[model samples]
Target chain A: MGILEVKDVGKRFGGLQALGDVNLSVKENTCHAIIGPNGAGKSTLLNCLVGKLIPDTGSVMFDGQSVLGRSPHEINQMGISRVFQTPEIFGDLTVMENMMIPLFAKRDGSYRLHAIKSVMNERQLREEAEQMLEEVNMLDKRHMHSASMSRGDKRRLEMAMCLIQRPKLLLLDEPTAGMARADTNNTIDLLKEIKEKRDITIAIIEHDMHVVFSLADRITVLAQGTPLVEDAPENIKGHPKVQEAYLGEAH
Target chain B: MFGLDKKDSTLLILVAVLTLLAPFILNPFPSDSGLAQFNAGYPDLMQRFVIFGIFAIGFNILFGLTGYLSFGHAAFLGVGSYSAVWMFKLLSMNILPAIILSVIISGLFALVIGFVSLRRSGIYFSILTLAFAQMSFALAYSVLTPITNGETGLQIALDDPRIFGGAVAADGSIPVTNLFGLEMRSAFDMAVGPWSFTFSAGYYVCAIVMLIAFYLAIRIFRSPFGMMLRAIKSNQTRMNYTGLNPKPYTLAAFVISGMYAGLAGGLMASMDPLAGAERMQWTASGEVVLMTILGGAGTLIGPVLGAGAIKYMENIFSKINDNVLHGWFAFLPDGMEDAVVWILHPFVGKGWHLTLGIIFMLVVIFLPGGLVEGGQRIARAFKGKKAKETSEKATTEPAE
Candidate 1:
């Protein structure tokens, strides 16, 4: 059995069926990519996995446990972390302070009243945050206010925030949706470094074939809210069904 | 020192020295001088400065840190005052139990109110808190008459049963609130040349309590819990996805701020043993908001400064009537003097709110960070533009 198993999941929003009878499995310690057309329910499927939306009829299992009813934070605490399409760092906090929040969450659980102890006193967490920044090349911007940073810096900071959590599963939604070529390549390199250095399973939804081919170990082609094919990138690249789905031609 | 960094320690000490020497600092003019009208050294007004300081400090924790604008915090303050007065009536006139019990009851009250109000956020959260506070005020005013004494307010009675202390003092008057044996109303008068200062026990008690409250606020600002609160203000979505629950964090801050308001209310009742339903009015709640914003919402010392400025103007400017305005313009020609006094008339005396309104408007528009940013601008102008360190500090979050 794979680490993550989705069994015939379906979702509806009002009168529209967003996802219909989707089944997928992700193996442990491998990068999985989901690529599809705009209206193919890619976001709907991602939301269901992260507890943002509940599937109307199906089960989502991460590891051995059903993750259907868990809240977003609870799902996160169960060793799953997601990077948003937009960089969502704490704009009103310093970069170093932003780095320390996930560390505190990892140590303290849902809520801990560490009101009397100063943040400066968390010497070990501070060092851990600094080390993470150093690895991401954000050490120089550690003291800078986060909201004022460039978009690339914010994305890098967001990536560092997720990586520092050391989650068992990492989910990325359009990780390089609006990036230039250099930044996109930089992000690919960073993801590669992170995957190589850590025992992590990554699931990415991407429109960019370049990013998908460069990183994903397995590609899942989704069309009209159903999985069209699940295979290696090379096999999927040459498939007529995949080409037709992308080019909007008659099959 | 005291688990604070050097800058925060210095700010704390500066506040300590200022509050301790307030009698001397506030009363800079001689008693008989015409400028003495501006001196805010008297016990009654001085107590108000510190009491309201504590109120604004607590309000800042919730509104400033978590970005939760609560418009009904005065309900907690009113509850605290009522509970403290009740303790005085049933128990001893000593203030320790009264104050501690007030904090706990206010905390519980905050938990109930915060639980309901925190379910919504932004303007909806504010309106919910405001509705709850209005309900509390209405209840305290009419429905809860038996306990709250209706419109007459809750006051210590002469014939009440006092198990621990006198129902009535040895002199037959109702017993005054005290800390052990020291009376809250007692004061020491000192005269040097033409200058006279009254060192009030009541003001000192309120001042000491305020210092402790301020110190704790500083600690909260520097703590990990404080960072979580700032994170909530910045982005709740990121907070949730990072595996941290924002609900419990915001609720905890609400309760902490409510307890601080309770402490202030308890201190107020300890000084003057009466609790009125009007204390819970929405206008009173708005005043603390004004104080927080006028001083600088997130900065450490902003609320205290805001409180002092408002209280000073309320007392001093109201004391000025047409007579005082006439005195200042006495040397002018009769026609010009009358015209000037008439022009200045609406801004002073009973119309001090007008002055406060204009000042608040200017501050909000020109200094969105509040008075702290105004001070920083003045300092920046003095130090010149080459001061890169200060400019860098300005770029950072104005949470200090």
Candidate 2:
């Protein structure tokens, strides 16, 4: 059985059917990519998995536990961490401080009052954050404010934040969206390095075919809220149905 | 010391020194001098300075750290005052029990108010708190008259059944609020080198309490809980996604600040032995807000400075009659003197609020970080000039 199982999930928003009878399973320790045209419900499906949106009919199981009806923080506590399309690092805080938050969350669960102790004196947490910054080549910028960093640096800091938790499943929603070619290649290399270094399962939703082909072990093509095809990268590239869905009918 | 870092310890020490020597520091002029009118060494005004400082410090914890602008905090203050007055009427003339009871009662009131108001965020949260405070004010004025003593206010009466101590003193007068056997009104007067200073028991007690409150606030600011509150302020959505619930943290901050306001209210009643419905009015709430913002909302010393500045101006400016204004501008020709007083008249005395309003506007507009930022800017400018001078000297010395 796969680590993540989506069983006939469906969602509707007013008069529009955002998702209808979507079913997919992602095996453990592999990079899975969901690609589709605009308005094809990739984000809606990701949102449902993360508990941001409740599916009207279906269950999302992560390790035999239902992710539905749980808060985003609860889902995160259950070893699921997501990277937003636009990096959501704490702007007013330093890069090291931003890294420490997830570490704190991972160690103390979702909500523990560490009120009396000074955060500056948390030697262990600070060391862990420094280690993570070094891994991302952002150790020099650790003292710099997160908001002052470039777009690429912000995305790297966000990835470092998520990775510090060592989440069982890392969900990336268009992780390389709106990036220059160099940054995009750098992100692909980082993902590759992460996959080789850690035992993590990645589920990424992307519109960039290059990003998908470069990182995804298995590819799922979604069309208008339904899974059109699920196959290996080689099979998906030549699939007749996938071509039609992307390029539309020629005649 | 006091679980504070070096900078915070220094700040606490500074505040302590300032408060302890207030009678000396505040009374800079000789007793018989014309400028003695500006001396703020009297017990009544000094008590207010420290009490309001505590109130602003607490407000800063919530609004400064969490970015939750509560408009009904004065309700907690009123609740504390009412509870303290009731304690004095029933328990004893000692201020200890009254102060403790006020803090606890106000904390509970804050819990209920915070629980309800925290369900909504942003402008809705503010409105909910405001509505709740208004309701409390109305109830104190009319509905809860028996407990609050209505418009005349709750005061010590001759027939009050003081269980711990006698209701009346040996002189057949209502008993005064005291700590142990020392009365709150007791003062020591000293005269040296043409200067006279009066130190009162009540002001010292309040000053000590304010110092403790300020110390605790410094600890809280350095704590991890404070970081979480700041995280919530920076971005609640990010906080939630990072596995932290913003609601509980924000609620805790709100309640803590409320208790601070309550403590201030209790101290006010302890010093004067009176509790009035007007204490909980919306304008009182606004005054605390103004104090917090005008001083510097997020900085540790900003709120206290703001509170002291406002209270000092209120006391000093309101005392400036037309006669005093004329005395200052006496050097000018008679016609120009009249023009000067005429221009400044509306901004002094009864028009002191107009001056305050103008100052508040300027601070908000130019110094959004409040007086603290303004201070920082001036300090930075001086530092920059010194650095430039040193650099120029170094460059010239190499050539010489």
Candidate 3:
């Protein structure tokens, strides 16, 4: 059984079917990629898994617990971390401060009124955050404001933030969607390093086939809200339906 | 020193020194001098300065940290005052219970209001709070007349049961608000040459309370909870996706600020022993907003500085009448003096708000971070100038 199981999930936005009978299972300790053409429900399926949307027809199970009705934060606490396409980060906070937030969430659950206790007094969290920053190659920029950093660094920090939680399921919604070739290469390398080093199950929705073929152990191709092919990455590379619908348009 | 880092410790000490010697510092002008009108050492005004300072400090925690703009905070202030006045009537004339009751009641009031208003964010949230405050003002003015005393306001009565103390003094007057046996209005007068200062018991009481409030604010500003609030302000989406609920945090901030406002209201009642519906008016809520933004919303000392500045201007400029102007411009030609006074009329007296408005506008336009940013810029400029001079001296010495 996979860590995440989406059973025939279907969703509608008004009259249009945004996601239609989407079935996806992301197994533990494997990098799974969901690649699709425009309006193919890649993001719709990701949203359903993260509890941003309630699938009208199906159940989303993360290790047997339903994430359908739960709020995004609750689902996050349930060991699912989402990295947004635009790199959502606390821009007003410093890099180190941004790093400490997830650590605090992981330790303190959803909410803890640690009002009087100084953030600087959290020596353990501070050290862990520093270590995470080091791992992401952002330790030198720890004191810099997260907003003022380069886009690449912000993405790195965001990834590090997600990684620090050690979430059971890491959902990346276009991690390198708008990156330059060099930055995209760096990100792919980072993902490769993370996959090799950690026991994390990643479920990424991407349009970049190079990124998909490089890291994905399993690839699911979707066309018009339905999975066209669910196979190993090596098999997905040669799949005629995926080549005709998605890979044909990109390159 | 008090669990604060060195920088925060220094700031607390500086504020402590300033407030402790406010009488001496504020009364720079001698009593006999014409500039004595500018002196803010009197008990009434000093009490107001500290009380409003406390209010602004609390308001800053929500608006400054979490970026939640609430426009109904004055309702809490009003509620606090009414509860305190009620406490004085039903329980005791002592200020402690009244202040405590004010904080508690206001916190409860804020909880309800914040819960409702925090459902929306940005301008919608602002409107919600404003609507709640207006509703509160309307209720306090008309519907809640029996409890609030309508337009005349709630006042301590001679017939009421002061369960902890006497209802009326032996002299046939209601006892004033006191701290134990010490009266809020009592003061020690000191005269040296032409200089004189009145250190009122009420001013000190208000000052001590404000100091505690300010210290607590500093602590909150440095805490993990504070960081979370800032994070929410930065990006609510990120905070949610990161598994932190922003709603409860914001509600806590709103409630805390409301309690602070309540404490201020209680202190106001402790100083005067009256509660009025006007205290909860929308304009009163706006004044605290102005104070927080004017002082520098996010900075620790900004709100207090803003409160003091606004109160000082209100007192000093409003007191500058035609007689005072005429005295100053006596040497000018009659026509010129009249023209000068006429030209300055719109910026002084009842029109002092125009001057404050202009200053606030300038501060907002030029220093978006508020007065704290202005101070930082000035400090940086001075440092830059000094560094240039030192560099010039080094070059000139080598040339010589």
Candidate 4:
């Protein structure tokens, strides 16, 4: 059995079926990428995984547990973290402060009462946030407001935010979308580094073939609300169905 | 522009000093003058300053942090006042039970409102709150009149049984509230350079409460829960996807803010022994919003500034009439005086609201962040440190 599994998941939005019967399994600590055309329901599938949307049919299982009916935070507590398509770091807070949020939640597993004295200054949480910031190469800019950062820096801060939660599974919804080519390459390197250093199972939805090829251990091609194929990246690059559905159409 | 690291303690110290000397400073105006008529240093006015400050501070928590614009907050305040008045009527004038009951009842009202309202986000949520508030107001005005006393408002009467400890007289006039037998109205007055500086016991009580409220606000602003509330404001979807249910946090904020309004209402009743239905009007709700915006919405100090500024203007403006307007321009030639009066009469005399309307429009248009931004711009213009640092940071950073 795989660490995370999707069994015959289907979702409908009004009269439109956003996702057909889709099945996939991700092995432990592997980087998986989902790619599809604009109308292919890739985002819908990602939302289903992160508890943003519930599937109309089938089940999503993480670490042998059903995640279908759980709230996002409950799912997160069960070791899943999501990074949105747009960089969604708290703009008013500093980079370090943003990182501290997930870290605090991870350590305490509760949003503390506003009336209570804060527990964020706990030594372990502070040290962990600092380590995560340094890993993301954002230690120096830690005090700067997250909103004031450039687009690439914002993504990096968000990455730090998600990673600091220390989730068993991390979901990225187009982490490199709208990024410059250089920034995309940096992100690829960052992912590669994270994969080597942390015991995290990552499922990323991306349009960038270069980013997918650089980081993904497994690739899933989606077309018309169904999985066209799931294979290793090398095999996916040459698959006939993937070519017709995505690659050939792209070129 | 005023960097958080600015070490000038003098400004804060000066403001503190001014507050300390307000009684003497405020006494210089002629007692009958328009400005003097609304002098907040007077027992009634001073009480209002602190009480409304509490109301606005609580409001800032919800509107400032969460970006939820609640149009019916006055209902909570009114409910609190009514509850407190009932405590005086049914129990005794002992303020502890009244204040406690006020908070609990207001919070319960807010909980019901928040639970339903939070189901929908954004403008829908705002409308939901407004609906609930209006419903509460309507009920209070009509259906619940038996309890609320309807348009006449709820008041303590001589027939009220003094079950709890309070200042009751043999003749049965409504008793003054006393804390452990010490009257809140007990005063300490000193003569200072041709003026009597009076620091009434009630003023001290209000000040202590205000300080505690301020400290609590500051603490909440710095907390993780505060961070989550802000996150909800900025991006609710993002917060949800990150494993947070924004509903609980927002609801908590709504209830907390409601309690603040309740406390303000309770204090108002305590200061004076009557509760009015008019206090629950939409206009009173709008006044708090105006205060929050005018001061500076998000900043800790902003709401207080907003409340004080608006209240000060209301006092000064409402007192001016055509006669007062003419008195100011009496030395001018007839034609010029008449022209000045013609220009100012509509806005200042009976039309003080016109002046307030224009000011509100100007602030909303030019200073969307309110007086906080205005203060920042002024500070930035004075120091130029803000500009220099940003340009330097820009130039020094390497391209990613």
DockQ leader: 1
Whichever of 3 and 4 has more DockQ, that candidate is 3
State the lDDT of candidate 2 residue by residue for B92-175, as single tens digits: 989999999999999999999999999998899999999999999999999899999899999999999989887889999998
Candidate 1: tens digits of C-alpha lDDT, residues A164-207: 99998999999998999999999999999998999999999998
Instruction: Give the CA lDDT, 0 to 100, for residue B125 in model 4.
Output: 75
Which pairs of residues clash in candidate 1, taking residues 3 or more apart in a chain or in different chains? B299-B400
Q: Which runs in model 3 stand beyond 4 Å of their true positions? A: B390-400
Off by over 4 Å in 4: B1-20, B28-39, B165-172, B185-194, B385-400
Count of residue pairs whose backbone atoms collide, per candidate? 1, 0, 0, 1
Model 1 lDDT tens row, B1-400: 9989999999999999999999999999999999999889989999999999999999999988999999999999999999999999999998889999999999999999999999999999999999999999999999899999989999999977778886989988899888998899999999999999999999998999999999999999999999999999999999999999999999999999999999988998999999999999999999999999999999989999999999999999988999999999999999999999999999999999999999999999999989899999998887886676678788775866
Query: Where does model 1 exceed 4 Å of error?
Result: A248-251, B385-400
**Per-residue CA lDDT of candidate 3, range B47-102, in tens?**
99999999999999999999999998899999999999999999999999999999
DockQ of 4: 0.41
lDDT of 2 at B32: 88
lDDT of candidate 3 vs native?
Answer: 0.93
TM values, all candidates: 0.97, 0.98, 0.98, 0.91
Model 1 Cα displacement at B180 (Å)?
0.7
User: How much is the lDDT of residue B395 in candidate 2?
Assistant: 95
Q: What is the C-alpha lDDT of each candidate?
A: 0.94, 0.92, 0.93, 0.81
